[model samples]
Target: MNDYTGFPAAARHLAAMIRCPSVTPDTAGTLDYLEKVLAPLGFNCQRVTFSEAGTADVDNLYARLGSGSPHLMFAGHTDVVPAGEEAAWALPPFGAEVKDGVMYGRGAVDMKGGIACFIAAVEAYLEKHGKPDGSVSFLITGDEEGPSVNGTDKLLQWAAGKGERWDASIVGEPSNPEAIGDMIKNGRRGSLSGRITVHGVQGHSAYPHLADNPVRGLMDLLDALLATPFDEETDHFQPTNMEVTTVDVGNPAVNVIPADATAGFNIRFNDTWDGDSLKAEILSRLEKGAKASRIRHGKDAPVNYSVDWVGRVSPVFLTRETELVGKLSAAIADVTGRTPELSTGGGTSDARFIKDYCPVVEFGLIGQTMHQVDERIALSDLDTLTAVYLRFLEGWFSGH
Candidate 1:
């Protein structure tokens, strides 16, 4: 096998990737390095860049080793969130410094490390068994943490237009909370965020009768949003819930009533609902709250409120690909000697997009310190995770 076929090689590659400082929406250096690594492994590497008017242009890498069926696409991002106050880190965030078996870096577990391990697994598999009977590819995006526009979804579309078809996929998102093999994300909840804006009259607070207080309306709207539970529980997902992130009137004075109020909320929903259904339900509650709140004040004027969905609403999904999930679970158990739970408990991931193309699951290193000032992963975990991936790669291809 080549030097990049084990934990040591994987660690070396990971450190090189970390040193690139490929923060989200910026990946020129990282893509170059990846092409260098994949080119030797017989991959036809393509450096893909995508852009939208308002979002940052992102660089991504798509590398494939073969051109046949049972194609397995390994998807991940090289981008790391900004390492806030690099000086606050115990080790340089981009240094990829190793101390006493732990590698400290910005993308250690959140997860350039996962990508590195997958590369190592593929390298070993190739060295041991020659070429796979089918195919293998990497869809590495650079905007997983940014305004996720111009990233995985776009890159997938680009690849699809080129006639790429994936039988199954694995997203290298750090799915475990404590250990590398404790969990596997077979699905993810959908995300919906929006602004609830209530229009009101501006006047002195002392003249309450003359000015409508939109704060009251905002409260009622929020109450309706929170009053009824979206669901109790599902077979594979947790209860759907919403949280009000902000309630703002932008009023600077205590004696004045604002002209408008806005409340922002985000919902993490399950397969029981989709984007349109969830939106309809939220609007219904908002309308009900507006009407009920209007009656509380005994007013003739309609409650003036508008709801605007924000950004892109992610639809909920579950992967029922039995072989994909079952074999991956068996691989984890084979390597770690523990049965991993198939879960759908995470917030959201690019897996949400990959789900539309092929059945995808998430399994990677432990994610305890992801996005923190001193994000790091244990050196031992590098070996363990690579083993899991190695096992999965062999099992998946052989079983297929």
Candidate 2:
């Protein structure tokens, strides 16, 4: 293997990337910077811009170095969440400042650092092995931190139309909560968000027979939804949970009952359930509770109610194949001298979209500071992650 003496160059490149205030749909010049770095590496880079009926146009990039089967893909996002309260930060959110051996920036751990390390590692590998044995590509999008309407989902379809296929894919999301090698995300719990708006007749608190109280109906529905445990423990996942995030009536007057009551909730389910089944289960529980609950002013009249669901459905998925998960885990141990946990915890990521195309997994720097104030990552950890990616590449291509 060719030795990479360009660790400083890689660090500088990452700093440049961090300097771009590419937050969500408005990726100032992040993609341009990426193209500049990849072009010299012999990657055929192309920008795919997409626009929806009402949303702003989004730009995504698909860069590939080689062609053929057994293709490997490294996917990530360049956009980051907004940096709140700049004055509260030790360094500017986009400064990419390195102090006392740690790089501080908005996207440092959440991901821009991973992209830099991988690109550098790939450059070093090509210096030694020439072109890779098969193929290697990058699928980067700017919409990961936004609505995600015109990002990886559309980019994947465009790539497939151009006859692109992958054997395995790795998303460089920071999956480790503690150290570089402490975790590897083999799967993620499916996320489903719903809003239960209970509609009822409005009434005065004193006039028992004049109005209806929607809050009581909403409470009953919430109780029914949470009454039965989704599951104690599935084979590969924890019990599914539903948390009531918000309940709003907007009733300022104490005596007036609100016409409508809304309760929003989200469920992180495991492999045992899918979108359709979970929806049915939720509706069933709500129906049963709504029938049993009697919202009465005195001892006579009860209120009638209805419920509605909101937002997109996310499916739960798990990848246990030995090739993708096993190989990456072994690589982590080899490089970091720690047995990484194969976890299914955490919220959804771009891996959710990639899983449909190929067996996908995630491993990168520790995410303890991701999306937090003064986000940062250690310089030594960057070197360790580069070595880990290099080791995985060598081992995976060697069929070991």
Candidate 3:
């Protein structure tokens, strides 16, 4: 077997991956390298490319070791965000340098490190337990850090089209906050975004009666949106919160009032409401604000405005499969001696798409340095995570 054949090979695998510089939407031959590593291990690897109307074409990989019941899938992406100003990094961003027993690179903790650990775990599992009774697969994509249009969502549909079904999935995202065993994300909240535009007439600043300033109307509408909370905290989720991300008038001149004003806001909601209900609530608030005479007391007409929902709504989801959660939790405790907190307190991930196909959870390396300057991972953390995954694999296939 090649040198990177078993559990101890994780760090080497990660070093090779970090050297690839596979930034968003570009695999940079990372998948090619992965295919070579998994093929000799009896995995049937299929490389697939997907494209849409305006999104970039993305390359994805699906590799399986067996075909049977209780199929377990490992999902992740190879893509990393840009390594801004490489000169600012302590080591070369793509050099995969190890200093003080820590590997530094762009994708070290954000994800490539997680993938490397899982690879080593699988290698170690096979070395000890031989072929698993059921199946194990890797569902990886290169478009995760980009538009996401041609990533896991499309890859899952494509796999399902070929009659692929998973009993459970583990997304190797950076889930831990402070340490390797800090948390495991079992659910994600729903997300909705929109832009509200208020219309008015253009006029010189000196002519107060000649123009209807949309800024005043926008303030009224914004006040209404924030006047009430979305809901109280749910059993498994925090209270729904909305933030206005941007306000734009697009007028460069201070002496002239702009013809229109727009504000963009996003809301992360819990089970208290779905996409449709949340939209209705926002519209209702805007109506109430428009009709109020506090800002435009002299104008009897309501504010002229419209709203546009942005992008697709990511529905909230929680994995309820006890066996899957219990076994993984046990595996972590076995290796780390700490009970991981089951959390649903983060932003969405590709697991949001995988949830529609099978129950999914996320666990990986600490995320303190992910997407930041000098991104790196402790060598000990890498080996620790690998051990956790190996234990999970052994327990999962044994139905223990």
Candidate 4:
């Protein structure tokens, strides 16, 4: 039997990447460091940069080893959210400092650790079984924490244009809530964000009869939106939820009624509906509520408002592919001695974009400290996750 000592520790690679501070929308030498690491592992690396009109340009890395059927692609993001204040953390966020068997850094668990472990596993596999029986690729992006306009979604298209076909994929997105093997995201809830604007005439607050008060219209519209439940529950998902994120008038004067009022909301939904169906449902509710949106007590006319869908709409998806789900579950069980739950409870991820091409699941390190003030991950857990990934790679390629 091959032992775990065949390759260097995963933490070494993780620390190297953490020191780069690859903040969202900025390469910041992260791609450079990753390419240098991957090239030595026999991967042909490509750095693809994508740009949208308003969003900042993002650089992504795609690397592949071998070219054959049953290609297994590992996807993740190298960019991390800002670390707030360096003085507030026990160790400097970009220092990658180790203390008492733990490593502290911004992307420690959210997840440069997952990336490191997967790479180490691949190295261990090569040291044990020679070149992989199938192909392996890395789809690392730098725009996951930003607007996500030009990261994995574009890299996938760029790769597809170059004739890359993937059989299955695993996104390392810190799927585990508490423990490394506790959860695997077989699917994700869809996300729909929209803005509701109510236009009214500006006037003096004392002369309420002459001018419409947009604030009243805004409250009524938002109430109608929140009054009803989107859905009770789905077979594999939680109930659909809507949260009103912000309501703004941007008016400072207390005596003047703002001419316009706007409210923003985001909905996390399930496979019982798609983007179109969910959007229609929301609009239907808004229209029905608009009838009661009266600025004046005697006014019976419905509110004049519009709904604008923001950015791209992610459709809810569930992976019913038995081969992909079964083998991944079995591999996690074999390594962790605990069966992983197939869950679809998190926010939207690049997996939504990946699902359009091939079946993708998510598994990674525990994320208790992700994006927190003093983010860190245990070194011992890092070793254990490396073993888990190594087992999965072997089992996946074994044609089971």
Candidate 5:
């Protein structure tokens, strides 16, 4: 058992984990390193590899301690996005360099740091209290930064098949934008993506009735979707907004009308809507616009089109019923002297999947630099987060 009191050791462990370069499908021994640290704490660890027919395989880990109900799971991802322009970093992105009072690395703030602190806190708690009265488990995946095809979603199913159940979960994503104690994510907005393709007859641009312009139809359909706001501010969420991310005609000659036009979009919506209802609404708007435009364009204009929903439909969720959120919030206030605002305003995370199984919330270090050029987290924040986790464990299991 290494010294849990030494925060330096925990930071060093995090640095070493970052150096593994475990980017998505290529774990590169990251899980092996984690097992080395966790096995000593009496965790029954297993590495589960999952694969979809057309997609690459992904490696994930499920480690549990204790064997009873009220199981608390800590979830996170060890994989990080590719470090672009590594030379621009003051320290190597994978160097895990600690300079001054902060640690610099690719996964420092996005994650990995949170995992390190939680492991250390749990180790300290076990050293003091022996085995916990309730179970503690870690649900870590390597595909979160990638396609998310074979990650927590599958691992949760695997654990459940083995008769594993969770009372609550905490995703160790960096939730606080300013400081560790400033925010706690009690919910997340749902996400939906879509693409629209408009088909038209190709012809010379100068010809009056020779061709139909698909780009015009696409522009009108896009206008219809964006013209009307999806919803005003809801109680637990912000107003839903959609953006056109890409528009492609693929025509090289300026004088020729493209045969087809394509546009891609995404929506971040609140709990006021679900995937089905939202999809219907979008389709209705597009259909209304397409029909009207086609009628107006008549036989000479090109207006044939199709719309497809792309990617997963992220469902909105809130964790108000769970004691984990309250306990962790109180613990944050106790340790940092700041009351965290329970919020759900952020991009989607793996919490979207975990929410279906157990009440889940997200809290970790400040996230100002996550996925940015030079990611870093202050050493003081690590200590504060560890203390918060320790207090939360005591308060939660003690039934406080």
Candidate 6:
């Protein structure tokens, strides 16, 4: 019930939360801290913990202010990536020290800042206008920076089970690149990862005729994957791109050819294809590469290889809810005087999972330092973003 009212309150909340050191999959008392602040704002906050067989159990919070329709969800995560080599930072990674108008900390911009801004905006809005005609909920999770198995996805399911449905969701994931209103991520490209292994005979490198080098086959296969463009840029998305992450022969001796070669790759695909179609296309290219005799030189057994799709496939999606998207854009313009670009160019986020439940978009602070040695954000940016969210809330609730 302490005073959690204005921009100063927001800054204090962020610094306190950062001091908790809530790294990925660890609450570090962040959820408890959030619940205390939220309860004072008349929100019924529920803390839920989810666990799966192989994934870490994650703590999550769902705080709702009203029970009516036109529900607006402010989704974000408190968990942050580890602060590697803390001595490399200008200030302590968890200290949340503000110097020359900037606050340096692990989750300052990447997300804890976003949550702080939203809370401040909500508190300010409620103080002036009481409760909105509709609803507002905070879907904060602690598993976004980890395997994402027990975070927003499960929290949403649990909330829905309790008869909660959202009209729209905004994931505060630092979507802006250079400034507060530079961009708004309306959608995200789908992500798929796989590892391909080619099996071959092991022998001395000097005896070329005695063994087949799987590396040769791997090179051709990878070339096939990259040689052709998946598609031209679509209306709402960019062309699909694939990158080879790891190429391993695991061979120790320089003279010996390894029995197998493996290459791990990840693909960020556009709306041009789904998981099934994309997988089929990849297999077709691999088959073509295996049949090619460029490096195999005439000894062709079709390049004995196998591919395993790693992890879960994140489906491509675009949020075209005109009302939800338009109001958010207008809100940004109202606050920053800059028309935010509708972008879908970044890597995947929890929005991919929330899209299935309701229309979702992303907008938050600038993200030049996320996961870097000295992650930080300008304190001015936090205030500006909080004002923008406050404007959006006012416009959205009034319109509804």
lDDT of each: 0.89, 0.84, 0.91, 0.88, 0.87, 0.91
lDDT of 4 by residue, 210-239 (tens): 889888888988888888887788899999
C-alpha displacement of 266 in model 3, angstroms? Answer: 1.2
Model 2: per-residue lDDT, tens digit, 298-325?
5343335555565567677788677987
Q: Where in model 4 is the C-alpha error above 4 Å?
A: 1-8
The global Cα lDDT (0 to 1) of model 6 is 0.91
Report the lDDT tens digits of candidate 3 across residue range 134-197.
9999999998888789989988999999999999999999999999888999999999999999
**Residue-wise lDDT of candidate 1 within 42-68, one digit each (tens)?**
999998889889788888889999999
Give the root-mean-square deviation of each candidate in angstroms.
2.7, 3.3, 2.5, 3.2, 2.6, 2.4
- Evaluation by lDDT, superior candidate among 1 and 2: 1
What is the Å distance of residue 150 in model 6 from its true position?
0.8
Model 4 — which ten-residue stretch has the worst lDDT? Answer: 1-10
Q: Which stretches of candidate 3 lie over 4 Å from their true place?
A: 1-7, 293-297
Pairs that clash in candidate 3: none
**TM accuracy, model 2:** 0.94
Residue 351 in model 5: shift from native, Å?
1.0
The regions of model 5 sitting more than 4 angstroms off are: 1-7, 294-302
Candidate 2 ranges with C-alpha deviation above 4 Å: 1-7, 206-208, 297-303
For model 6 the local lDDT of residue 302 reads 80
Each candidate structure's count of clashing pairs: 0, 1, 0, 0, 0, 0
lDDT string for model 5 (1-400, tens) is 1222545555767877888887776888888998998999999999999999877899999999999877999999999988889989988888887777788889898799889889878987898888888899999999999888899899999999999999999888999988879999999989999999999888888883777788888988998899999999888899998989999999889999888999999999987799999999998898888876752255644357898899899898888885687789889989999999989898989998998898999998888988888898888888888888888988888892
Off by over 4 Å in 1: 1-7, 295-298
